[model samples]
Target: MDTDLSLHASAPSPPTSPPGPKGLPVLGSLLDMGSDILGFFPKCAERYGDVVAFRLGSWPAVLLNHPDDVEHVFVDAHEDFIKNRFFWRQVTAIFGKGLLTNEGEDWLRHRRIAAPAFATRRVNDYADTMVQLTSEMLDTWTPGEVRNAHADMMSLTLRIAAKTLFDASVEADVAAMDNALNDITREITARFSRPFVIPDRVPLPGHVRYNRALRRIETIVTRIIAERQRHPGDRGDLLSALMRAHYDDGRPLSDKQLRDEAVTMLLAGHETTALALSWTVHLLSQHPSVDERLSAEVHRIIGKRRPVFEDLAELTYTGQIIIEAMRLYPPAWLIGREAVKDCEIGGYHLPSGTTIFVSPWIMHRDPRFFDDPLSFRPGRWTPEFTRQLPRFAYMPFGGGPRICIGKAFALMEASLILAAMVQRFRFQWGGDRPIKPSASITLRPKGGVPVRLHERENS
Candidate 1:
């Protein structure tokens, strides 16, 4: 293959650099990036320049560290660079071709149908649902005691997603579903990073566990879909909306498509929001001033009442806290793409079939963009400050034509849950250890975040 590393076929060029990381002769840099890959790009940034190129089994890989270069990949030349099939292939084992996995026309088609269901009004309608479910979760939370905040948030948000999206609460079976989702996400993550794993049905330890968990998830999702189909539009939740939705050609989604979408929403809708909220609370716990301000905002806005959609605009600080949390720990940390044709970005030649990674985790915290990048300062996200930041510098939910369909829904849910939690409890760190980042699909605390919750008294 004549690699077309050129802006113009005849243009002169700088000398090509050697490929990054001399690993196993055939495997190249995959092992290096995969092992201790949690903050792989940051370490790479410290070593390489803003735009670093490497290889994974002869497949070219580029990691863009600067905001402008990140834009050049996701927004500026989006059409030319689609979601890498390999990244989606891992999800393909379970989700088939849901919105998150598909590319080109199929992605566009699914988005067209699912997008309206996540409209401002539709998502706003979900605020009451979020408040109602969160209130129920809070009823169990006796304050002034220590508990695993991550587990609590995950449980609460998963229930909210089930109720709001499916009109079906997991009830006693929620734990089983949670465990299954966690297993599946971890398995898929391992698969993505190590692509040479044997067939999942081969009964290796990892494959055995992963396959069993996937079957459980499929069974649970299918039952929910079948039950919802029987009762149909009476539910008035996301399942009903998707059940009623039609493509431009008047085609409703198939059972497989429906199942994929419902499960995707179940995982995507709740997991990321819970992770974001968990980190938000953890950050606030260490910064009493931020937590105090947030508590005051919630108290003044709702005053012992449940939150309403109308309260969102007035909940400005709540929104900032969520944005800042996402900046620090974006649930979907890395977005990957593959080039279909020769392209030139930032004066560098990108040949066809190159794999590219744009990491929100790195970009949002890049020292070039954020002052004191590691600090937990919600005030930094003031309206004016946000306006001054680069457009693609902080895409917690991602950007371009493939932006998160549930962006509106996730934000509303996060803010509502945060307000609902703040209205009652103040989180205090239960452990002296610093929170560490871990990932399977969503960014999560390495171990669950434990916090002592204290109920606010006297308003």
Candidate 2:
């Protein structure tokens, strides 16, 4: 499908000018946009101008492709928008009224309840646990080994989350939690495309998978809560902290609410961070100069010693590399919103109940703001470069009050793991196959990232 919405089109009428992509009568350019999720954005920008309009299921969406436009949507007019139900309702089906899916008063209440535990000092406190778990993961790996970086990251992050969230030390129980988290993620991904398909009542695929995942999640979360109730101790993990939290009206979280929150943190906490770490390693493997620069920085920061909480500030370049990797391949690729009332944006009208989509995968790489947008360049994240960039053009953890509660946790975990990995090891690509972004709730490497991890000769 092709759209020619130019001002001068075969001299048709005396027209004032505005830029927009002309969509096909029905399907629009969605089919031409390709099947791969992240692959379509750059192409869309090339064909259309910055604010490109398109459609999905008869709902018109304006893709904000410039930094200024991104700023307008997220920061300037934030209150007018909220998380689109179409995208999050599937997640809410399992996680319930956890922080990620709710908005308005309920969201604010939950965020306040969850805030104390995610405070900066508390996140720093969890660094020790993150490092310990990361070291444990590395100890299992032999030097000069070929391994799936993705798999290693998943297991490592799950362990960190397990220890950090519940303070649980049982290996078998942790393994079970990891397995349950995986099943929940898979189910969430499947439900996105099969939105209308009724969940099975009995042992059907969706029903069976959903029930099994929910049961596993509930069993673990309930057991932890019960133990805390039976013999409360302030272990400094999130669960223990929440255990002591009370809402504004002297109300505390209900048992179901606690379970929902545990499910939310366990699933949201580890999954995206794992993907980001895996991608950072993969990008490092492909870009040797970058790898060399990062290795030098890591070695200079902590010679023959593991990273501590204080190391995060001095490891500026390492943080830049992670930021750049997320910019190139943000784990949470697409964010959506729905309008609750009639609204006008960029001189066009959007109706009440309209579904809106905002894709970071599209905006982060917009050429108007970024030079050589598709290329991986951590240097772009220097303090000076950061000051010059528009605010909402780079939101890996989202924006506004609804921004990820676990952003600090994810960053701390990533910085520590990346710094630790680079201090002792260098990774090289295992093959020539291109790693594509596969968006399924989170942006994942379509297949898997295979890399060779060789211990640094002189570290």
Candidate 3:
């Protein structure tokens, strides 16, 4: 049984400054948020109510828990908002002028160029590659071996991303890329906590690692872009697709533009899907009944064969398990959008430059929107249930036009990889202390989902 919803209920404060906990006078919620960022927001919502106002140092911020308000910022009134510069400026340091950082027409053009490659028909073509890579990795796993499933999923997804993007196996290049990404994410996480951030030009040791990581990424992406330019043709990979794209006036994309799009796809494409699968694997290990049900579904639908893109339709239960896991542990945990102009949301005044945070982590677990929100219940995702819920209530990929472009690509990739893994191995979570979430920008399993593998016998 779940906790009673009535016990957790609270009322919103009056419209004066969108009522919330008034933290320390000078530093505001800085210490509190820094100590426990994920738990802090919900605690405010629980006590101060839905439209909770808080501060991240001098910056005025608000946490909007309801889906209608989420819709306002993400969709209905998006034109009046921009990616919160406080956070995205740091992200821009890593992503450059990629789709993730670009806004307005520049963003539109890049999105237009890259969109075709991720179209369902086109994305489905990579199903074989997704499963093939998973199979290759599974072949390396020993039945009784203890392994970091998160690391395994990360490596496998990176391999798949490289093959699908570069049309070459980057197995040899994986370690360098992996190390580079690790350093980059670490540097960015450090930046997020600090209200007063040190400029990247400063030769701090962390900044040095940050710059070195950028160079490594640049080297690999540059090599691939240069090669593609020298031999430009449609190769059915993402890079080739971008290389083949042209502006309406017949102008070709600049080298810098190519670099931005490539790095964006290479990093964002693999990381999110990898995290989704990692969490799903972790959740399945914790609940054997759920795991067994998932295996039965995969076996029934796939029948001793690997899953193809077509099988995704019949793999409904497999899809639900992944969906439920994401609801429990969203990869892109929080989204920050700053208002460019004053606006009204939830019948309260939001002034210009207010950074509004709409966290999927908090919203997905709201008792008002979901019954027994704390439990891992995949079966709740029925058509009627989804239809009844507000659109933003369960947005793992986010909402609106600026939503993740790789949405189709990601869902397909996660589902296929998850289905394939269960078909081959059963995980046993032999733990000392329970694995904890290390949420910086994305929520990751702190150390990794370390578990012992028990290979499934052939049917």
lDDT of 2 by residue, 334-388 (tens): 7777777766655556666656666778777877668999899999887787888
Best-matching candidate per TM-score: 3
| Model 3 spans > 4 angstroms off | 1-15
Cα RMSD to the true fold for all candidates: 4.4, 5.8, 6.7
TM-score of 3: 0.94
In order of appearance, the predictions have TM-scores of: 0.93, 0.88, 0.94
What ranking of all candidate models by lDDT puts the best one first? 3, 1, 2
Q: Residue 398 in candidate 1 has what lDDT?
A: 82
Compose the digit string of candidate 3's lDDT tens values, residues 46-81.
Answer: 987778888877888899999989998999988998
Q: Provide the overall lDDT of each model, using Cα atoms, as 2-decimal numbers.
A: 0.81, 0.77, 0.87
Give the residue spans of candidate 1 off by over 4 A.
Answer: 1-11, 14-19, 193-197, 247-251
State the RMSD for candidate 1. Answer: 4.4
| Candidate 1 global CA lDDT score | 0.81
lDDT-wise, the better of 1 and 3 is 3
